[model samples]
Target: MTMESAKLPDGPMSGLVASAVEYMVDAGQRNVLFLDIMRKRGDQYREHVAQTAPHVLQYAAELVIDGRKLAEPVNYALVRIVPPEGVEIDKNRRPFVVVDPRAGHGPGIGGFKADSEIGVAMKAGHPCYFIGFLPDPMPGQTIERIARAEAIFIEKVISLHPDADGKPCVIGNCQAGWAVMILASLRPELFGPLIIAGAPLAYWAGVHGKYPMRYSGGLLGGSWLTALTSDLGAGKFDGAWLVQNFENQNPSNTLWTKQYNVYSKVDTEADRYLEFERWWGGHVNLNAEEIQFIVDELFVGNNLAAGKIEMSDGRKVDLRNIRSPIVVFCSEGDNITPPQQALHWIPECYADVDEIRAYGQTIVYTVHQTVGHLGIFVSGGVAKKEHAEFSSNIDLIDILPPGLYEATFEAKGEETASSDLVVGHWVMRCEARTLDDIRAMGGNSPEDERRFATAKRVSEINLTAYQKLVQPWVKAMATPQMAEWAHKMHPLRLQYELFSSENPYMATVKSLAEKAAEERKPVSQDNPFLAFQEQMSKQIVHALDSWRDSQEAMSEALFLGIYGSPALQAAVGIDPKSTPSARREMPPEHRAMLEKRISELRSRIEDGGLREAALRALLYIGSARGMVDERSIEALRQIRDEQGGARMTLPEFKMLVREQFFILLLDQGAALAAIPNMLPDDLNVRREAFRAMRRVLSASEDITGEREKRLRQIAGMFGDAVEEGDRESNVAPFDSKAKAS
Candidate 1:
């Protein structure tokens, strides 16, 4: 073996040997340098703290005044975002309310900068309002109470903008995502378009080896620790705990790179880092009840997908009950909330896509190939592109027929020129998604469902026992005095406190820090060590991610192997939603109904006539082909209009056209060539058809991104229609080189 090969053997031993040597070399250096850097960083941190002391003092004073002022107000506020320098309300314009997530963090991320969510809405000339809260919670605030308060808040926004749309478009981020969902479900009439970013919904469902946060509750014996922590805190669950959990998920950044990057790039990165840290470090508390409810019902039980979640009044919080168009933004690279956790909730809640159509719920989801969880909301690049596209196309998304669609944002290449009609810099396509496509993500297996069910049961039993026997004593001891003391001592809260006038050292460093900040200059990007630092940072992140994945895979294997075995399966019992197991247990009558329904659909497929068949086939083919633009759609429409009779009603016309379109695609030779031949020269027609297809897709029962891309290609085939060697003759005269080639 080579020297290198000798140094590193194969299998487990190789990893051990490599790790030991690396650890010995770097660990010693890291131990020495890490302490000195940390001490300096801590000094700098305290110095910055000293500078911000006055602001913290002022904020604390304002909080005291506000708390006293709102002694009798309950949950109500007149939130003014941008006070008019001199701008008047346009009666025709709508209003916007952006609710920032209080997910173990303070508010204002939605409007942290001038070019943020609030900025976009204001730029659109909408009357924008921000729903923010004090760092401290109300004496006894529950999530349900917060949802009701949000509804009331939106109602007030509507009242302010009298001539605008009746309801305001509410945007929720992270934890607030499910809150808005609950609000929309409870008060559907009060909401317009609902936007959820980086939201975790179907928590139980995720990719095989990604997003292991949801698995922790089960592994750690459910949410008993949440209750224990709350009890220890004397009632209020420390939001710092939640923030710490988030930090733990990404150890490399939390432990090293985040602060290191700031120090290394202090000049330019200081302001941005401090701005983000202001929010990131501003952790807020939740009631013990609130945290328990979230962990037990949403995370462990996965009740949202099961449609078992209830409101304070015991009313069910069914996701399908929400009438407004729901927009879900997720990413493949998001480790906290993967696309499966964010988007799969729809399919999990509904039996199939058709059921979604039957319920008249408009659900649209977009999956970015690679963007981290925070990037979904905080990345200016994503905000400019994805958010901008969604903002511009809100009306289009709203008008789509009730169904499920995957919204895709595609940047136009140099070959593609921008049209006068396209508002956004980028172009986009909305296509249907299928149930099977969603199921491919996870949480479908019989064993997986059963394990989750067991978790739910354990949580219920544990929570019930805690509430029955221990809650009274805990509450009795959790007096106002204790809560206040706990808040003052909290590490997250202490950061603010230490930076305020309360610190004896603050006055001394305050002036020096100011001058230092003003004179601050960051390390050069071209510095040799800078590249090494970044490389090291990325390597650490990758190692953490790999470790996380391996842990998840091992956990899943153990759970499935142990609980999924025949003996354990028989002993543990299975959930009704569990596949294979549930399918086997279906009642005779329900089974008959399902079989009959399948047979009926099959019969309808077989008996479909030429026109109907053509339309169906076209829908299928158009779905398979990437028929995104105006040309292909116009051809489909023209065929429909020509074949459609003037006397036909809208429904009849649609049916007839759809039928004919299907038949055209089903016929191999003539129909395929004929469909393209009949299409008008104007690409606008294809574009409209593409839009129509999206609208239809929205109302479709089940469709998927993969299938939609395929359909676009099919439509493109028509646009691509070429006669071999007959191009010079111009016999067809429909010779479009771009399409054909």
Candidate 2:
């Protein structure tokens, strides 16, 4: 071979070396850019921390009522969101109040973006109000005081929209969910419809292997650590610790995947990462008293669902007292607040479906198949679909008869029936559910409950011992200055501080990043070295995930072994042979009240006119279908708007629906037979009412099966009033003598 031929091979080697060098330079530039983004994130965190009133809400807002000025002072305040350009607010439409959870982080996760809970409500023309809190709690503040303050905020909204068609719809995300429930139970009259997303009311309820967070209290020897942490913070619990606990749940995500994603996509992911960190890093403080109550009464003791919690005013917080509809939105993939924790409270509160109807309560719950805990309120996709559907159909939910329901949503497509009636991209339906269905979701077994009961008892003992033995000395050693130092030094906060401008080392990163950006040479997507780097990252994530799973498994096993001990149960004053009481007993007065209400409803079974008859006929048809669609509700709304004298306010409509439902529930045969009696004497009026009922029933699609049979039966009962001219009805009115008997 000639020397020139050998030199040709050298040229290919040189080119390969040049490509390698280019990749190296690109990688170095990407690293600088990533570091620069982190520095910016840290700076933003510091700026957010410095703000006196910081919130992550994406909309402009005006303060309406400051809870700090309320009679029962709290750190929370209510603000009205100013709609953005091109969005119109209907003052006559029911307002929406969004309350973000105060669990460890500062507020505004519900309104973190334009496609959020607040955004959807605003897009639907409802006035929006936000309830957020300061980073620091007022001295001696408690959860009860905060709840009262929220009630006052709602009252202010009610006054502002006096002409609204319905009461304001309140949405509580995460920790705020139970807080809203407590307030709603105490002041049921103040609420309209409630949307609770990812809230854990049944704290001790969970699947054994899937949920590890529930075992933390037991593994830590029950809430004594919480007390110590609170004391260390000098009467204020650092929310950073809660954030740390959350991070600890998925070590792979926290330690590797989260940072790796931003590093890998430095060009596109920095802004999104920084925005989320702004909320995640903005740690808030809880009053020691408030956290103690939350840990002892709610988390460890699991008293909230049992109706065992009593306020300082001696009034018990019974969830069954709330008259408004309760909508629970949870997810199967939420490890933090699992479906069991969100839904087990229903069976705890009511014995069965009959009992739920007897109390005249409407409870609707939706379980998403695969969204994480934060995604329940934070994900834009979830916000657009589930939250949007709930906001648009809240009035329909409000008018639903007393029962348990499961709300399900399906994506709208070309094949969808009555697509024009759907307000958004998804169609929503509420199917009647039973308590047995909730039980099938998987809660703790009987043995598991006993173990948790023992854990609760142990927590009480440990808490009492700590209070008497260790608390006094700790309190003496704690000072406000020391607490401030501790908070500033928290690992979560230090990461931001250390990378920020405060750290002189990060000063060079910005200039380096600028130089790198100007001479940027990005690697090809199919580069072998880049692929190797991604593979290595994946291995690291897998290793961390394996470590997390092992740790969780060990922790769960240890908790179960320790808490399930027969000797420990006896030591904690629990009998091993006895069953743990999971449900609360209804008081005599409450039971008597329910009985009295049912009796009164039975007496008026034959009463009411066209509105009542229409409601009864609709309910009769709907009962056979066992589901409710949003299109049907929209048709009902249209009918209400079109009719002159027959138009009813939402509240009046809700009351009428409930009354008619109870009448049907009490006497199905008699109620159906008496429909003709409730109709007006005029043939035209009867025809109009019958046509309206048929329109609602046929809104979604053509009614068939059992529903069609029930509809035809209703038409037969209407006789010539619906068929032709002035002909007397064949079906007779209900016998007043039989009702007296």
Candidate 3:
């Protein structure tokens, strides 16, 4: 080729540069379009708010308290939510305490509406009390103080509901989840079943590409920024910063669609958007010390999962120490708190599921497939379903034998279904799970742990340097006026600013928009713009997804590179050590009794013959599946009558059967094949039996791949036997045998 041809118009280098420029211009244009639409939507949102301000103000005014007339400033004071007229508290019912999270948001979310956790408890004939705080914390309020106040509140709730079997059932959401755990550990006697929703305990455990939020602290140079932020806030960190982080997790929803949703469907979605904003925009503050402790001891340090976190008096905050059943609610799709973060703590803190059971600690976790973080608490559909089931079944969970179980819910229309089916007609069963099963979801490894440990060390150095050199200057310069200004000017705070009278054109547009909506002129569902907006929103979402993926890759690479190095690996040992003993200090009598029970269980298993174990396992499966069938129940009744009139209660009988199931699972073989239809065809009973079988398998110690192989072999034998019977080739042979006889 000639030089002229190669160097002429649109040359090779120019072509590449031009392509880059074109791509940038296209992206810029799309962003500008999105911003313009969002701004217009923002204006519309403000207008709608202005129109509804009067009615909302009136409703809010009804509950307003005069600042000068506030009660004594103790965090733990007896408080009651005055039930509305015609709604009476059930004096005889158990009491419930709903603790709302102060993480970047105000209180009342636990009871934000009528169909909520509080509402469900109320409908279930339980006395309900909500633990909410003011929009601001008291000066110098510490987390320890809050914990003490909660304990006091529980005492009052207990005294009020004297006849209840257990103390008030505490429901803690998000940040409050940890707070509740702390309270429970310090004063275990003041609590009942503890429900922690969307909480992260095993903060260091998560899947490789699924949880990117955990890497943000290390990526941002550790906890120094947290200290700097707190110092900037005049020793009280603004919670809006935390809220802003949450918003950034999903930019499209927070930046564009959140407002667009109201503009496009202004008439229908306006109330919901405003109601949620009322809670979301009201940010609270945490003491600098509290934030630092959370960062060093929980998030960056991952000390809580390691059983190293200690209080001022040096009492360890061992989650395993709490005697109450812990019901962990998390979601598979929650990037903020994934299933691994919520669940891996069990295996990390203990050796096996049996160890957990041996401690008499019942843990039941329900992992939703696709609900995001806030949906665990906010979505009415979710609250009505999941929360409702949990509240109704606390008794069942409380009594369930110790083991790792995955709680599942299935919708049913019939009333005569399994006992796991609750009022809403959803059948819930606890499936047995193994450590390997739990490990499959966790991305934890030696390298990841080492990197986290390094992060912890770096955080300590950063914190010390700031405290020694920079903190005094920051506190001296940051006045209360400056802190207040900072809070108001935060980007997260501006969500409330636009709706205020600060906008000049708000009034006229407000009237016009309200009139337009009232006149029945609104955007149709089929409107081209609405469809276009959704499509564009999805594209933005995809862009955010790409960004998240890139960040996750870098994080994983950094972790592996830092921890996988020979020097670092030698410095920090990350491989998990041998399982720890479960000999927790307790009353001598109780300990001895527990040991004796374990010994007896072992003795029984050893003495029982393999045939007896197999037969018992088959019978147990029959009992489980039998609960679903009328005929099976009849057979059980017949056996009971013939075997000298029933002796054990149903629960006791079920327990006996389960013991046999585990014994059989320990020695798996063709003998197990003798029992046919172990899992019945009836959907309800089959599910129950499957769950029961899992419980037995999880409780056993000798379970391994050999047991699984034997089960397969047994299944194969049964299949072969069925096939042989089906074939018709041996009739002449049978006839010849009969003639010879």
- What TM-score against the true fold does each predicted structure earn? 0.68, 0.95, 0.71
| Model 2, runs deviating above 4 Å | 1-19, 724-741
Q: Model 3 segments beyond 4 Å from truth? A: 1-78, 81-90, 415-422, 518-534, 555-741
Say which candidate scores most in lDDT. 2
In the predicted model 3, the residue pairs found to clash are: none
Q: State the C-alpha lDDT per candidate.
A: 0.61, 0.88, 0.62
Write the number of the candidate with greater TM-score, choosing between 1 and 3. 3
Which candidate, 2 or 3, has the higher lDDT?
A: 2
Task: Name the top TM-score candidate.
Answer: 2
Given candidate 3, what's the lDDT at residue 453? 64
Model 1 gets an lDDT of 0.61
Error of 1 at 575 (Å): 6.9
lDDT by residue for model 2 (1-741), tens = 887666424676776766677679888999999999989989999999899988899999999998888777899999999999999998989999999999999988989999999999999999999999999999879998888889899999999999998888999999999999999999999999999999999999988777899998888889898999999999999999999989999899999999999988888899899999999999999999999999999999899888889999899889989888999999999999999999999998888988888777899999999999999999999999999999888888999999999999988987776677788999899999999899999888878898999998888888889999999999999998999999999999999888897889888998899998899888887777788889999999999989998998898888888888999989888888887767777789988997898899888988888878888988988888888999889977877778657467889888888889888888898888888888878887887777777767777766677877776788777777666421232122112221122
Q: Per-residue lDDT of 1-741 in model 3, one digit per residue for the tens?
A: 987667525667675555555445433443333333334445543553344121111111122222212332433233455555555666755577888787877666777777777776766666777676654556656777677767767887788778674567789998888889878878987877888999888787776766878877776767988988998888888888889889877776877678767655544565677667666666667878878888878888877767677777888777767877788899887889888888888777667776676566767788888999988887777777788777766655554545666777767543332222134545556666667777777666655666666666656777788889998898899998998898778876575566454566556555544444444433344544446667887887788767766767887677656645656434444333323231244447656977787566555654443234334553433323211222123323334455474355434544554455444434434325334434333444433333233223322111235444443333343333323432222121112222232
